[model samples]
Target: MLTLRMFIQKSDVISFKNMEDLYSRLNISKNLKDEFKSLISELNDYLDRYSPLTINSHEMRFEKLSTSEPNPDQLTNRELMDIYLYGDYAHLDSSKRVRFERIAQNNLFAPMGNHVFVTIVNKLVEIIDRAVEMNKQAIEQLKDQI
Candidate 1:
Protein backbone atom coordinates (compact mmCIF):
# COMPACT_ATOMS: atom_id res chain seq x y z
CA MET A 1 0.00 0.00 0.00
CA LEU A 2 2.72 2.43 0.93
CA THR A 3 4.67 1.38 -2.14
CA LEU A 4 1.83 2.30 -4.47
CA ARG A 5 1.14 5.49 -2.61
CA MET A 6 4.77 6.52 -2.89
CA PHE A 7 5.89 5.09 -6.24
CA ILE A 8 2.92 4.33 -8.46
CA GLN A 9 0.88 6.97 -10.22
CA LYS A 10 -2.88 6.52 -10.27
CA SER A 11 -5.52 9.17 -10.81
CA ASP A 12 -7.38 8.23 -7.66
CA VAL A 13 -4.39 7.81 -5.42
CA ILE A 14 -2.29 10.48 -3.73
CA SER A 15 1.26 9.55 -4.68
CA PHE A 16 4.66 11.04 -3.97
CA LYS A 17 4.34 13.02 -7.19
CA ASN A 18 1.09 14.40 -5.92
CA MET A 19 2.68 15.28 -2.60
CA GLU A 20 5.57 16.93 -4.41
CA ASP A 21 3.16 19.12 -6.29
CA LEU A 22 1.23 19.86 -3.13
CA TYR A 23 4.38 20.87 -1.35
CA SER A 24 5.25 23.21 -4.20
CA ARG A 25 1.77 24.70 -4.33
CA LEU A 26 1.84 25.23 -0.59
CA ASN A 27 5.07 27.19 -1.15
CA ILE A 28 7.21 24.86 0.91
CA SER A 29 10.92 25.66 0.68
CA LYS A 30 12.07 22.19 -0.31
CA ASN A 31 11.57 20.72 -3.75
CA LEU A 32 10.28 17.22 -2.98
CA LYS A 33 10.65 15.83 -6.49
CA ASP A 34 14.33 16.72 -6.55
CA GLU A 35 14.79 15.30 -3.08
CA PHE A 36 13.30 11.98 -4.18
CA LYS A 37 15.61 11.85 -7.18
CA SER A 38 18.59 12.51 -4.95
CA LEU A 39 17.55 9.73 -2.61
CA ILE A 40 17.25 7.27 -5.50
CA SER A 41 20.66 8.32 -6.78
CA GLU A 42 22.22 7.66 -3.36
CA LEU A 43 20.46 4.31 -3.15
CA ASN A 44 21.76 3.31 -6.57
CA ASP A 45 25.34 3.95 -5.52
CA TYR A 46 24.88 1.91 -2.34
CA LEU A 47 23.22 -0.91 -4.26
CA ASP A 48 26.04 -1.20 -6.79
CA ARG A 49 28.61 -1.75 -4.03
CA TYR A 50 26.45 -3.96 -1.79
CA SER A 51 23.69 -5.65 -3.72
CA PRO A 52 20.52 -7.01 -2.21
CA LEU A 53 22.08 -10.48 -2.23
CA THR A 54 23.41 -11.95 0.97
CA ILE A 55 27.15 -12.42 1.47
CA ASN A 56 26.65 -16.17 2.09
CA SER A 57 24.55 -17.24 -0.91
CA HIS A 58 27.13 -20.03 -1.27
CA GLU A 59 25.46 -21.87 1.60
CA MET A 60 22.06 -21.79 -0.13
CA ARG A 61 20.73 -22.76 -3.55
CA PHE A 62 22.28 -21.13 -6.62
CA GLU A 63 20.09 -22.49 -9.36
CA LYS A 64 17.88 -19.41 -9.53
CA LEU A 65 20.76 -16.98 -9.60
CA SER A 66 22.45 -17.61 -12.95
CA THR A 67 25.72 -15.81 -12.22
CA SER A 68 28.27 -16.46 -9.45
CA GLU A 69 27.69 -12.87 -8.42
CA PRO A 70 24.05 -12.09 -7.75
CA ASN A 71 22.02 -9.47 -9.66
CA PRO A 72 21.61 -9.33 -13.41
CA ASP A 73 24.04 -7.92 -15.92
CA GLN A 74 23.64 -4.15 -16.50
CA LEU A 75 20.41 -4.12 -14.51
CA THR A 76 20.43 -0.97 -12.41
CA ASN A 77 19.18 -0.76 -8.86
CA ARG A 78 16.47 1.65 -10.11
CA GLU A 79 15.17 -0.98 -12.53
CA LEU A 80 15.13 -3.75 -9.93
CA MET A 81 13.47 -1.42 -7.47
CA ASP A 82 10.65 -0.69 -9.92
CA ILE A 83 10.27 -4.36 -10.79
CA TYR A 84 10.00 -5.38 -7.16
CA LEU A 85 7.64 -2.56 -6.38
CA TYR A 86 5.17 -3.35 -9.15
CA GLY A 87 5.52 -7.11 -9.39
CA ASP A 88 5.48 -7.99 -5.71
CA TYR A 89 4.08 -5.10 -3.76
CA ALA A 90 1.59 -3.13 -5.79
CA HIS A 91 -0.07 -3.61 -9.19
CA LEU A 92 1.10 -6.43 -11.47
CA ASP A 93 2.61 -5.65 -14.85
CA SER A 94 2.08 -8.27 -17.52
CA SER A 95 4.95 -6.86 -19.59
CA LYS A 96 7.43 -7.51 -16.81
CA ARG A 97 6.66 -11.21 -16.36
CA VAL A 98 10.13 -12.42 -17.25
CA ARG A 99 12.04 -10.03 -15.00
CA PHE A 100 9.46 -10.26 -12.28
CA GLU A 101 9.67 -14.04 -12.20
CA ARG A 102 13.41 -13.80 -11.89
CA ILE A 103 13.01 -11.65 -8.81
CA ALA A 104 10.28 -13.82 -7.33
CA GLN A 105 12.18 -17.10 -7.58
CA ASN A 106 15.37 -15.75 -6.01
CA ASN A 107 14.68 -16.83 -2.44
CA LEU A 108 18.24 -16.39 -1.22
CA PHE A 109 18.19 -12.64 -1.63
CA ALA A 110 14.52 -12.15 -0.90
CA PRO A 111 14.94 -11.30 2.76
CA MET A 112 17.79 -8.85 2.16
CA GLY A 113 16.08 -7.27 -0.82
CA ASN A 114 12.85 -6.89 1.11
CA HIS A 115 14.69 -5.36 4.05
CA VAL A 116 16.39 -2.82 1.80
CA PHE A 117 13.18 -2.03 0.00
CA VAL A 118 11.32 -1.43 3.26
CA THR A 119 14.14 0.78 4.47
CA ILE A 120 13.89 2.85 1.30
CA VAL A 121 10.18 3.29 1.85
CA ASN A 122 10.78 4.31 5.44
CA LYS A 123 13.30 6.91 4.28
CA LEU A 124 10.76 8.35 1.86
CA VAL A 125 8.23 8.70 4.65
CA GLU A 126 10.84 10.43 6.77
CA ILE A 127 11.60 12.93 4.00
CA ILE A 128 7.93 13.72 3.64
CA ASP A 129 7.52 14.04 7.40
CA ARG A 130 10.39 16.46 7.61
CA ALA A 131 9.07 18.52 4.71
CA VAL A 132 5.70 18.82 6.44
CA GLU A 133 7.30 19.81 9.72
CA MET A 134 9.50 22.40 8.06
CA ASN A 135 6.49 24.09 6.49
CA LYS A 136 4.05 23.68 9.38
CA GLN A 137 4.55 27.05 10.98
CA ALA A 138 4.28 28.97 7.71
CA ILE A 139 1.21 26.98 6.67
CA GLU A 140 -0.47 27.66 9.96
CA GLN A 141 0.09 31.39 9.46
CA LEU A 142 -1.21 31.25 5.89
CA LYS A 143 -4.39 29.58 7.08
CA ASP A 144 -5.13 32.53 9.32
CA GLN A 145 -4.79 35.02 6.43
CA ILE A 146 -7.37 33.13 4.38
Candidate 2:
Protein backbone atom coordinates (compact mmCIF):
# COMPACT_ATOMS: atom_id res chain seq x y z
CA MET A 1 0.00 0.00 0.00
CA LEU A 2 3.03 2.29 0.18
CA THR A 3 2.97 4.87 -2.58
CA LEU A 4 5.97 6.69 -4.07
CA ARG A 5 4.87 9.83 -2.23
CA MET A 6 4.74 7.94 1.06
CA PHE A 7 8.10 6.31 0.44
CA ILE A 8 9.78 9.61 -0.27
CA GLN A 9 8.20 11.66 2.50
CA LYS A 10 10.75 13.79 4.35
CA SER A 11 8.98 13.41 7.69
CA ASP A 12 8.98 9.61 7.48
CA VAL A 13 12.64 9.45 6.44
CA ILE A 14 13.86 11.82 9.15
CA SER A 15 13.53 9.29 11.97
CA PHE A 16 16.08 6.77 10.69
CA LYS A 17 19.69 7.66 10.06
CA ASN A 18 21.01 4.14 10.53
CA MET A 19 19.99 0.64 11.48
CA GLU A 20 20.43 1.14 15.24
CA ASP A 21 18.08 4.12 15.12
CA LEU A 22 15.59 2.16 13.03
CA TYR A 23 15.67 -0.73 15.46
CA SER A 24 15.08 1.64 18.35
CA ARG A 25 12.19 3.30 16.58
CA LEU A 26 10.61 -0.06 15.74
CA ASN A 27 11.14 -1.33 19.33
CA ILE A 28 12.77 -4.47 17.96
CA SER A 29 13.72 -7.12 20.47
CA LYS A 30 17.37 -7.29 21.49
CA ASN A 31 17.68 -10.78 20.02
CA LEU A 32 16.41 -9.71 16.58
CA LYS A 33 18.17 -6.39 16.76
CA ASP A 34 21.51 -8.01 16.02
CA GLU A 35 20.15 -9.67 12.89
CA PHE A 36 18.51 -6.50 11.65
CA LYS A 37 21.66 -4.60 12.51
CA SER A 38 23.71 -6.90 10.31
CA LEU A 39 21.31 -6.46 7.42
CA ILE A 40 21.23 -2.72 7.87
CA SER A 41 24.99 -2.59 8.10
CA GLU A 42 25.26 -4.33 4.75
CA LEU A 43 22.73 -1.98 3.22
CA ASN A 44 24.54 1.02 4.67
CA ASP A 45 27.81 -0.17 3.23
CA TYR A 46 26.27 -0.57 -0.20
CA LEU A 47 24.69 2.89 0.03
CA ASP A 48 27.91 4.49 1.19
CA ARG A 49 29.83 2.90 -1.61
CA TYR A 50 27.35 3.45 -4.44
CA SER A 51 24.91 6.25 -3.63
CA PRO A 52 25.11 9.61 -5.43
CA LEU A 53 25.89 12.89 -3.69
CA THR A 54 22.93 15.18 -2.98
CA ILE A 55 22.86 18.82 -4.05
CA ASN A 56 21.68 21.17 -1.30
CA SER A 57 19.01 23.83 -1.76
CA HIS A 58 21.73 26.46 -2.00
CA GLU A 59 23.06 24.63 -5.02
CA MET A 60 19.69 24.57 -6.72
CA ARG A 61 19.03 27.53 -9.04
CA PHE A 62 15.28 27.34 -9.01
CA GLU A 63 13.50 30.21 -7.34
CA LYS A 64 11.00 29.21 -4.64
CA LEU A 65 13.30 26.62 -3.22
CA SER A 66 11.82 26.07 0.21
CA THR A 67 12.51 28.61 2.95
CA SER A 68 12.11 25.79 5.45
CA GLU A 69 14.34 23.07 4.11
CA PRO A 70 15.15 19.73 5.72
CA ASN A 71 18.50 19.83 7.43
CA PRO A 72 21.12 18.52 5.01
CA ASP A 73 22.95 16.93 7.91
CA GLN A 74 19.80 15.13 9.03
CA LEU A 75 18.95 13.41 5.75
CA THR A 76 18.88 9.62 5.89
CA ASN A 77 20.54 7.46 3.23
CA ARG A 78 17.17 6.77 1.65
CA GLU A 79 16.28 10.44 1.65
CA LEU A 80 19.60 11.28 0.11
CA MET A 81 18.97 8.68 -2.58
CA ASP A 82 15.51 10.11 -3.17
CA ILE A 83 16.97 13.56 -3.69
CA TYR A 84 19.46 12.21 -6.18
CA LEU A 85 16.72 10.23 -7.88
CA TYR A 86 14.13 13.00 -8.13
CA GLY A 87 15.74 16.41 -7.73
CA ASP A 88 16.64 18.59 -10.68
CA TYR A 89 20.38 18.83 -11.18
CA ALA A 90 20.62 20.99 -14.32
CA HIS A 91 22.39 23.69 -12.33
CA LEU A 92 24.95 21.57 -10.53
CA ASP A 93 28.53 22.70 -10.06
CA SER A 94 31.24 21.55 -12.42
CA SER A 95 32.25 18.46 -10.47
CA LYS A 96 28.66 17.49 -9.76
CA ARG A 97 27.79 18.13 -13.39
CA VAL A 98 30.49 15.72 -14.49
CA ARG A 99 29.24 13.11 -12.08
CA PHE A 100 25.68 13.57 -13.17
CA GLU A 101 26.69 13.21 -16.79
CA ARG A 102 28.43 9.94 -15.97
CA ILE A 103 25.29 8.70 -14.33
CA ALA A 104 23.25 9.74 -17.32
CA GLN A 105 25.60 7.98 -19.69
CA ASN A 106 25.12 4.78 -17.83
CA ASN A 107 21.38 5.10 -18.11
CA LEU A 108 21.01 6.29 -21.69
CA PHE A 109 17.57 4.81 -22.25
CA ALA A 110 16.46 4.77 -18.62
CA PRO A 111 13.27 6.56 -17.73
CA MET A 112 15.20 9.30 -15.90
CA GLY A 113 18.59 8.84 -17.57
CA ASN A 114 20.23 8.13 -14.21
CA HIS A 115 21.01 4.47 -13.76
CA VAL A 116 23.10 4.85 -10.63
CA PHE A 117 20.34 6.80 -8.98
CA VAL A 118 17.79 4.21 -9.98
CA THR A 119 19.93 1.35 -8.70
CA ILE A 120 20.48 2.96 -5.32
CA VAL A 121 16.83 3.93 -4.98
CA ASN A 122 15.75 0.39 -5.81
CA LYS A 123 18.11 -1.00 -3.18
CA LEU A 124 16.77 1.42 -0.60
CA VAL A 125 13.24 0.41 -1.47
CA GLU A 126 14.22 -3.23 -1.02
CA ILE A 127 15.59 -2.49 2.41
CA ILE A 128 12.38 -0.80 3.43
CA ASP A 129 10.35 -3.69 2.06
CA ARG A 130 12.43 -6.16 4.03
CA ALA A 131 11.93 -4.17 7.19
CA VAL A 132 8.19 -4.08 6.67
CA GLU A 133 8.07 -7.81 6.06
CA MET A 134 10.07 -8.42 9.22
CA ASN A 135 7.65 -6.31 11.21
CA LYS A 136 4.69 -8.19 9.80
CA GLN A 137 6.24 -11.53 10.67
CA ALA A 138 6.91 -10.35 14.20
CA ILE A 139 3.33 -9.12 14.58
CA GLU A 140 1.96 -12.43 13.33
CA GLN A 141 4.13 -14.33 15.77
CA LEU A 142 2.84 -12.20 18.62
CA LYS A 143 -0.71 -12.81 17.48
CA ASP A 144 -0.15 -16.56 17.46
CA GLN A 145 1.36 -16.45 20.92
CA ILE A 146 -1.68 -14.60 22.17
**RMSD after CA superposition, every candidate:** 6.8, 10.7
- The prediction achieving the highest lDDT against the true structure is 1
All candidates' lDDT scores? 0.51, 0.50
Relative to the true structure, candidate 1 has a C-alpha RMSD (angstroms) of: 6.8
lDDT of 2 by residue, 56-138 (tens): 43332112223365435333345445444444332234554543444344433233334545666677678778767766765
Candidate 1, poorest ten consecutive residues by summed lDDT:
54-63
Residues 1-146, candidate 1: write the lDDT tens digits.
Answer: 54434533535445545554555566433554455445444544644443333223233222243436654343434455566666665677764444666545677655655665666566556655655664465577467778
Residue 49, candidate 2: Cα error in Å is 0.5
Task: Show where candidate 1 strays beyond 4 Å.
Answer: 2-13, 27-77
Q: How well does candidate 2 score on lDDT at residue 67?
A: 38
